[model samples]
Target: MAKRSLPILSDGAAKKILRDLCKQHNVSLELVTQMIEIQRENLGRGRQIGITQDFSAAIAEFLDSASIVRGE
Candidate 1:
């Protein structure tokens, strides 16, 4: 059998996923927005590229840490 591949999400789709996750988890949208801004700043003055995975990873990590902190 051939290995299955995941489809790449568009930027808007990825943002929506992050936003929804925040809402579902009771995480503040403001914090998520700040996290996104921090990621963009970290990318610096180069052409922005491959942001989908980075954004998703940031949200996932933030959620993980938040849960750990809250002992959820």
Candidate 2:
């Protein structure tokens, strides 16, 4: 069987979908906004670490941060 691929959405399209889903489900848009901010920060950090060629450090940092956020 051939592998299937999902369609990539632009930022506006993705945000609109998320906003609609959130509204339908009575979810808070602020929560969605925070999630996006966290992801963007992680991406920026990863890009910075990539320039330094420290993927292991990046993985460790991400794991540590995630654990802290989850109160693990």
Candidate 3:
């Protein structure tokens, strides 16, 4: 699949999304927000956050494995 760009977010939307992700993952949104801020800064400077694509692919692969295991 082709890579896609995610947009910059206002504080509210970013916080909301981060909160939802953290809740789903049983993580702390504060920590996730730190990472998001860093990613945003890197993206703003036109530097690709290296390995993000690979990371995404890896997550997809992991989920695919689970789905297969579950006969999904």
| lDDT top scorer | 1
* CA lDDT, candidate 1, residue 9: 26
Q: For residues 1-72, what per-residue lDDT tens digits would candidate 1 score against the true structure?
A: 442322222367776787788799888666667665656455655766766666777778877888899899
Model 1's alpha-carbon lDDT is: 0.66
Angstrom error of the Cα, residue 28, model 1: value is: 6.2
Q: Give the poorly placed runs of model 2, Cα more than 4 Å off.
A: 1-16, 44-72
Model 3 agreement with the true structure over 1-72: per-residue lDDT tens digits: 543444433467866876787789865554454456546555545657564774465556656866798799
Q: lDDT of all predictions, in order shown?
A: 0.66, 0.56, 0.60
Clashes of 3: 0
Rank candidates by TM-score, best first: 1, 2, 3
Single out the weakest 10-residue window by summed lDDT for candidate 2: 1-10
Q: What TM-score, to 2 decimals, does candidate 2 have?
A: 0.36
The regions of model 1 sitting more than 4 angstroms off are 1-47
